[model samples]
Target: MSPCCNWMWGLSRRLVLSGRCQLSARHNVDVHRSFSSVPHPPRVCVVGSGPAGFYTAQHLLKHHTEVLVDIYEKLPVPFGLVRFGVAPDHPEVKNVINTFTQTAQSERCGFFGNVTIGNDVTVEELQAAYHAVVLSYGAEDKRELGIPGEDLPGVYAARDFVGWYNGLPYNRHLNPDLSSDTAIILGQGNVALDVARILLSPIELLKKTDITQCALDALIQSHVRRVLLIGRRGPLQVAFTIKELREMLHLPGTRPRLDPNDYQGLGDITKDLPRPRKRLTELLVKSALEEPTEKDATRWSVAEREWSLRFFRSPIEILPSKDGNKAAGVRLSVTRIEGTGDNSIAVPTGQVEDVSGGLVLSSIGYKSIPISQAVPFLPKQGVIPNSMGRVKESPGLYCSGWVKRGPVGVITTTMSDGFETAQAILEDMKSGNLNCSESRPGAAAIQKLLSLKQIQPISFSDWEKIDAVETARGLEIGKPREKILDPQEMLSVVSN
Candidate 1:
């Protein structure tokens, strides 16, 4: 055992003995005596090394003096979605990685990558080996469009497409066919905007990012000239924030096409909306009403690609071509909002419209899956049932991020969620609800189990080696670090 494990085990044994003595004395004298010696530190196991898990660990370490945290990740690499889900062009968003790196470097923290909880070890096993177990695995499964012809060849999910270009190992072979001249994305979130931007951006811009070489090469040969972003509600109900919208509006070589009529009633109510929404709606109105400058007219005349946001349209079905093998168009049902502002709901108008498009992508949202039988999951909501981040009816179990709440919000939201969960853990410890007096081997026991199972878990140092190699390789190609798109390749990089 490592020296740290030995110290934890020894300290735990002493605390257990001291607690037993206090209990005996209290029974004999009918008086309670406080055990002055600091209680054994809690050993926490956090599943998933995403922002949620890292932030949770950070807060736990900050609030607790001697607590030990171990984060387990299924992938050899860390920074779950930040590394694989964030758009490559938005490198600023990835700066959180530096903070996460500091958390991993904490003396009381340990990272066990390439260790899947449900497969290599079960949730019950983790709970047995630690005082508290936190499940922040996040939402990996995506919500389906559930419309007819969704399985067509040219139809894809935005999640998989984003993963493909972002070098998610599982989607490395997606190799989507971009031979179509027009593409339709059925959602109006930031992800939808990202897809539109990637499809319309100049190839030289994407080449400088960390986007996979395969996706970049494919984009260079893409025939896509038009992208249509379809949302179920009106412009006032757009889910994307202003930053993403502004980026799309300013994308070079791409003309924004919004029907001026869509902005007719929005101008009168902009002031009544909240600050964020008001600003966003104002930008949309400006873009819609602005007349083209002489320079803009010249650029539009020679523009090779364009993107438009189509409101009040919900996808009813994907229409296949005569061959019935590939997507040729989309059938949308016209929708109208019943209420104003965020409470607005889309109601179908019974009128149908057909928009011709050879390629389609559904970017609705993501869903969380139950990792193990031990976890109580709300299937309808696709989240773990929790009360303020504490797992309901399950002691020694907690959850954060999308698994605790629903899959929504930005990175800052997730950080706050993680901190809340960590606070819950600290409260439980202080209240003696989390009994840390008994010794638990923590990561040492987990390591033994993994060794017996022949699973060689990757360490943080190993991931850094892989990171160095990827960076060096990218430097040769005049781009940001190119990602290893295969698990085996990542492991090999770490090994060498």
Candidate 2:
């Protein structure tokens, strides 16, 4: 371990030995008695067992030596988006799950899976049971395009598509039609690129990953040859980072369909842009200007798929087929950038273009939904209303991650948000703002309530059983792990 980790471990050990911790308002355990006599320590309840929740628990446990944390997850499994939202090919990002598992294994920590906050337990119940309640449930709802024919058969949200391939239980039945020769994605973000990559990637390469067998089978039969990524802004305003773009450009048996005209004047402004934007724009310009090399030409000769970035185009409607039942193409309004830099806005030019495509995936973004009436949610912003991490007008109620801020940022960003929220809770405790006089029974009390309701919550050990079954099933098929895409099957795995 590193010196910092050693110090933290030593500090935790010392705190436990001293037994100078005070019970929170919810923790009814008598602090005056010996640590062994107190059945419950100062406890915190974190909703949602995602990265944000685990990170928050980690920080709280690290700083408050005697605190007990119970994480509640709606799914029988854990690692939320890391398991269900991240691209299957990006396995390195999933390595953080190891750290989360270590946190869950902590003596002071507990995991309660298959517990929905709104249905299984209310916010009021959790607040009454724990000293602090941290809401880390991430944004699960996808933003809609609100265009005509958006609800057509061939239209799909990028969120559902991602969940479908990643084996999320909710999207297991999303059997998207892949018989189209062309696909249109209505965003220029990394998700759009991921969707495109999955559509065009070789079946042999996909078969090696943890992608759902059903999704893999669909791709094997896919007739999609071209993918067009439509963005409402200029090339410089594309939301995708350089790494994903680079991967798409170098994908075997595929080539980028970039237009030189789109990158004509970007070279002169590249130097003045921010480092990330500068690098991304430079790469885009280079790719647009460079001619296919001999090797690339040879590869292009056999290329079976291609993807292009369409800038300054906003979808007005999803044009329906002659039968008026399924999406046949997209009608786009031409747009021009006004002003410059990040502040530039796309203004429609009153010119319309029709692009034919059999399938359309809207990758706009994600939005947070109100978990319950208790949470002070700002529906307009799709986030919880809060000052720092504390929810407005709700004492001991906190929020973190996408729900606290907005649906944006990566894992590192959520981790930092979790740490900040943990710090705020610690500060409040130190300031006596979080009264610990009233004894809160914590998880023991909550478990009793669950038992009374006949709801069997899945423990961390239980999740391990499910995990084992998944791994063994995957081994049989020569892939990573075949996920249990049904909640009932997941529960059955644990029960058996």
RMSD list, candidates in order = 9.6, 9.3
Candidate 2 least-lDDT 10 residues: 19-28
Please provide, for model 1 over 1-496, each residue's C-alpha lDDT reduced to its tens digit, 9 standing for 90 to 100.
2458435433432333332332222122111123224555578989999999999999998988788888999887999999988999999999999999998887778888877788778999899889999999999888999999999999999999999999987788888989999999999999999999999999989989999999999999999999999999999889999999988877888888889999987888999999999999999998888787788777777877899999999999999999997999999999989987789899999999999999899999989999998899999999999998999999999999999998899999999999999999999999988888897768767766765555666778778988998899899999889888867667666545
Off by over 4 Å in 1: 1-39, 292-298
* TM-score quality measure for candidate 1: 0.91
Clashing pairs in 2: 24-436, 25-435, 25-436, 26-440, 27-440, 28-439, 28-440
Q: How close is candidate 2 to the true structure, as a TM-score?
A: 0.91
Candidate 2 ranges beyond 4 A from true positions: 1-40
